[model samples]
Target chain A: MKVKEIMTKDLTAAEPTMTVRELIELFYQSGLSSVPVVNEEGRIVGIISERDIIEGALPGYFEVLYGITDMNHLSQKLREIEHDRIEFYMTPEVIKIEEDEDDLTAADLMIRKNVKSLPVVNKDGILVGMLRRIDLLKDLL
Target chain B: MIITVTPNPAIDKIYWIEQLCLDAGELPVMRATRSYLTAGGKGINVSIFLARMGIENIAMGFIAGETGRAVERRVRDEGITTSFIWVEGETRTNVTLLERGHEQRPIQITEQGPTVPPDALKRLLIHYKRALNRARYVFLGGSLPPGVPTQFYQELTHIAHQHHVPVIVNAAGEALAHALLEKPWLVKPDTRQHTEIAGASLKTPREILAAGKEWTARGIEAVLVSHHITHDLLITCEGAWDLEARDVQFQNLLGAEDALIAGVLSATVQGASLLEAARFGMAAATASAESEELVVTDRTAIERVLPKIHIEQLL
Candidate 1:
């Protein structure tokens, strides 16, 4: 089977101008942990995951990892930057697979890259669909 | 470039249930065995069909919140250029429940979309005016969203005319009323909302023909109206045609009208005459009606039904 046949065509993406609060609502409504960020032409420019937002919300995330600050004090600061745009937090580098590729290739990329989801694109680099780890396991089970 | 505008766009959801429990007496739990979701609106549907036919077109309108984002994604996936202006509330989602035994009568519940503010319309006009420079044809379709004036399409028609671009309007009621004042190049009164056209109830074929003639006589270039699923009547400056498609297998009737318009646009862009293009449009509508998918993507499905369309000239 091709990736296009199995990929989730119910794509929910975000624009560069969308705020963190808006992205949170998108994740909540779509039941998705991550979404690809596209330009005006709908070409994939970056990808943002729930982890990125959660970690970005924590002002002390990096300090906590280095054992510098207590993790329990991470409150009230999230509200301060709710208006910050997702473009600043999103990883501009994205790993995307073509829709016409073999399904196994998509599975391999996800497993090897340790990504929970991958944005599916066509030959012109336009975001077409999204594939998650659970989607890859559907046919197997 | 062809620009299609859908003032009220939606994310259409269809759920196929084995047996839908419609009993109001008892608490019902309906589980869908299958489901499909896609971007929907007359103009958006035509954009998808046109994109599949390798006709480059831009999908434009006001979209809001997450549903709006999904609509854009779905349209982009179909290779359409998107120029949607984001507004304040969530875009509406229309649900269609298709029961196993009763596939003919699908239950649809639609929500009124976000009220587009006046400023949003201003922004859209500015963008639309810029887009008109490259536009070969502009299509204004669907109902007017809340907070929008009834004469919005008519005003847009005048703007398109100022640029020497022909405009096609597919609307009903007041929106259709105002559009006629400007004399759009082609008018297709949306009969789905109300079965009335040109201030007359469309109960009989003769009435629909009369309604088409009424608009065409007022200096409108053409008027096309659906008589039923398999039949339609088209009136143009040169003549009128009553078109019908035979051997149509009833599957899903959604998007058939838009498919017809898309077919006509796709063929007309390739230099086909209005009569022949309307024939192809009927064939496309028949093929779309015969398929389970909302929009038929394969060109051969339309080609297979082309010869079966019977077009009889009137007047």
Candidate 2:
């Protein structure tokens, strides 16, 4: 079966210019930790997740990067870039799959990329839907 | 940012039933073979169209109850930014029944929508003014719900102009008439409800051109009038042009006008000339009319239908 057969439909994407605060609200509204970011032409430019938001928002993140504990500064860090756009923090190198690709290939790519959700594109490379890891576990298993 | 204001938004439940029974006697309930639920509001339709074309825009309006929430969620899924003001009562739900053979005349039962309380209208003004700060274009579409004054569009147009933003007024009857006095950038009166626009006849090509020219002469930038779903006449500051879509098998005409508005505005924002924009818009409308969906957004399919859309400038 093709990935499109089980992939979620009517997936929403965020624009790169959206503020971190806005993206967070979107994550809350969509109940998704991450969403594909698209350019003006609707092509997938990157994918942003709670991981990126956490990394980008938290102050003293540099120290925390080296495994230093800094939970106290989390609130301060989140407010610092609340208004900053997500372009810099987003993962520009996106690993996407074609909608028509086999379900086995989709699951294999997820394992290789170590990602939970993969953006699905059409033959024209336009973002269409998203295939979640949970969907794979439910269907492929 | 482009802001689309849908004064009254609705959830459209379209059902393709097995058959239509017209007798006065009691009949068995028809079964639906297919169905679709869409976010239905003129401005919302345009917002969806713009979003699908990769243009970021804001969909603003008043919403109420769970039906309203459903409409907002559906449009948000299309990637259109929504700034809805919550009101009391349930938002309207329009039921459209389409028979297999009579696709043209779908039975429609639409409610008047939720009443906008005084506080909600005030909040809308505040939000509208704030949105105007970043707005490049504003589209005021659909009719006012109960409790909202007819001069609502006029007031919004006046404020948008104060912010130096071009406003597109797409309404009918008193709403369109009041907005006209504000000299909106363009006026595309909603013709779905009535054959006549502000007591003006659009029955013939000559009357359509005359009517379009009348609005343009009122210091408005342009006026677009549709005729018989096959042709459209556009009168702009520079000149007038006639666009005719040939050989289109119209499956549904519900959202064609809104698609035209979106197509034109999308092109206008991209720096396309008025003539070119009208041509593109008519093609989009034609593509929409030929499909069962409310609005068709496939770029390739729309472009393929472009050549069949003939346009000629009027002397």
Candidate 3:
């Protein structure tokens, strides 16, 4: 079996400029922990997980909870928060796999790096599919 | 309230063909093909099945690009309510080929998905926390995306604990192993996954049961083993129980595991006993095996198989 043999082709991805609130809503509706971050060309650029949002919002959240009480002031703060983009918090370092890689090779990379998934790209570095650990195990079975 | 997360979701393209052939310098062709793009993800599948069974849940994850938009649109089109994290990458597409007339086998092809940045992952965690504030059950399913650590599930499990929410994890390998320390409410690992996690080639049901018990003792509230060829075993805090399904005419096997999870969670949410929920899971799984499509088992089908499923206590 190869990586293409058991990877997920149809995907749901995320954009760099999406707002935090919108991202949260997307996470709720989609039931996924992390989403692939891509550019206009549909290239795999980065990834955002649930952790990033939670951690990023923590400081601002604390400010609202302990530092402010006035409704009008909180509303003004909320606006600033809403304008935040995903690019502000997204991790820049990304690890990906080519689409033609063998399944074993992909599995080996995941195991070696202790990562759960890897982005698949074509020759042009266009985002194509996702190779997940569960998919790999499913293939193993 | 229950919330499930699916980071990399797809519009599953299932193709039914008479035969599949590949020739040198000839494009691989399929015969008599049929295609459907359903909301695809372990978490989303659970949510949809649960919803069909009248279990209210919020489907949470990520959506990106055009494919992501289509998936969200289609899911909403199904009347299944969903909330997603919008990102930059286009959602993936998964293909499954069913050789109908020839040998009744399936060939599944998947793509390597888009990369998720660390910030996106962070935003996702924050979203989970927000959802956790309202949810009683949190189901973290599917695989982590690129740029996220294998311990992502483990982190979520910890956060769920902080919010006093029970977590159920359906994953494999390091992702699964690392999360066990958090003592999730449930962990459903297929037989092969169990073998890999245990680092041994298990042969007998007894060995599998023993492994389940061990995991349960280690803080996992329940360990559900989905056997490849045999009955599924449910190891709860009480004891080990084997729920066996009667042999029935089969159609497709895909999505059976997800259906089982949905059934179990649905029953549990309704305050059903572990035994009862295990029976529900078994019945749902059996029903999935009887359907050609990945639709949730109807109430009648589930009830019909309920009596046929035998549960044996292994205490």
Candidate 4:
């Protein structure tokens, strides 16, 4: 089977300019853990995940240790970066696969890179779909 | 038609229950008499209130995923037209737990919306420009989604200005600061949001007035600050006025600001003076607070509160 056979053809992509607020909303609405960052020309530029957002918004350990805790302080911290563009936090060096690639190759790349999903692109490097680790497992079964 | 933009819209899930406080690591059991979800976002709320007042408006913004679709559907169901840019990902869900026993204190958790890519943003802008062709006013509300520039509202204001459509911005902090540069027709920030931009504590009404004056001098046409429902201050290039509604039992103060904006817009579009608009806005806010709903729809309710609204000139 090729990558396109089992991949989620209807993929959701994000823009670099999307703010953390917008990303979280998308996450809540779509229930997707991560989303591919695509540019205006449909090129995959980066990838962002729920883990990235948590890590990006994480306060310094010193602040926590020093008892700098309160809804006010936390909300303030959020406001500081809530408007920040996604490019600031997304993994810019994206690992992607081509749509024509075989499922075995896609699975191999996922294992080698330790990534859960690979953005599947076309011959022109345009994002066409996404292949997840679960898809490969279902194929194995 | 008025166009309101909620760049990051949400499905506001309000849980109404009794007994909210709980012991550590223990869950407090309670039952909800009624629970409901509404399409929420500052811009969307403004549109709802505007529609309630028989004002036709379109709600425009980004909607993603299933939740986003639901928001669009619900808003459309409210008899308001929607022109949303369908982007990848989902719209956010804002949960508000209303504790009726605990003095009606509400705890809210908000989710950030999807990242709007450049292409999606371009589409939204194009949609907005087209909407502006028939727009009498533009209400840009709420915080922006990720990947959107901090100065995004400024661009919207610029576009509205180009079409001779005055804009009213209801935002906070950096977003409000950027919009100020574009000189929106009016900006209604809560006390905290206004003071954050003022870089000083506007503890007194006089101090808030001074801050509003400074903003007007910096090219902004008007600044309205709501001081915790006690009073609302409106300062414009024409003059300054302090608006207050006395002897009021507050019900739900959720969409008061949006209602206020709707009232002002409602008055302004009908060739009313800024002072008259401010008066009507104050009345509208009072009516909204007196209602269990997000915004007051009955003109009688607004009229009942109109006498209570006191607007005094300060400058």
Tell me the TM-score that candidate 1 gets on chain A alone: 0.87
Question: TM-scores for all candidates?
Answer: 0.71, 0.70, 0.68, 0.67
B1-315 per-residue lDDT for model 4 (tens digits): 788999999998877776665663567666776777889998988888777777878888888888987887688666676667777877999987767744235678889899989867886786677567667889998988998898899999998998999899988878877888888888886454356763735667777788888888888888888775558888987788888899877766766777888888888888888889988888888888776677786778888889999878888
Q: Give residue B146's error in model 1 in angstroms.
A: 0.7
Candidate 4 lDDT by residue in tens digits, A114-138 = 9999988878787766788877888
Candidate 2 runs further than 4 Å off = A1-141
Clashes of each: 0, 1, 78, 23
Tell me what TM-score chain B of candidate 1 gets against the true chain B: 0.96
Model 1 lDDT per residue over A1-141, tens place:
788767765435677777888777656644567888987556888989877876787744765586526444544555666799999889999999998998789989998999888899888787767777777898457
In candidate 1 chain B, what residue range of length 10 has the lowest lDDT sum? B122-131
Displacement of residue B88 (Cα, Å) in model 2 is 0.5
Ranking 1 against 3 by TM-score, winner:
1
Give lDDT tens digits, candidate 3, residues B158-260: 9999989999998877788788879899988644434666463334678778877788878788988766443888887788888887776667767888888
Docking quality category of candidate 2 according to DockQ thresholds: incorrect
Q: Which candidate leads in TM-score?
A: 1
- State in Å the error of residue B107, model 1: 1.3
- If both were scored by DockQ, which would come out higher, candidate 1 or candidate 3? 1
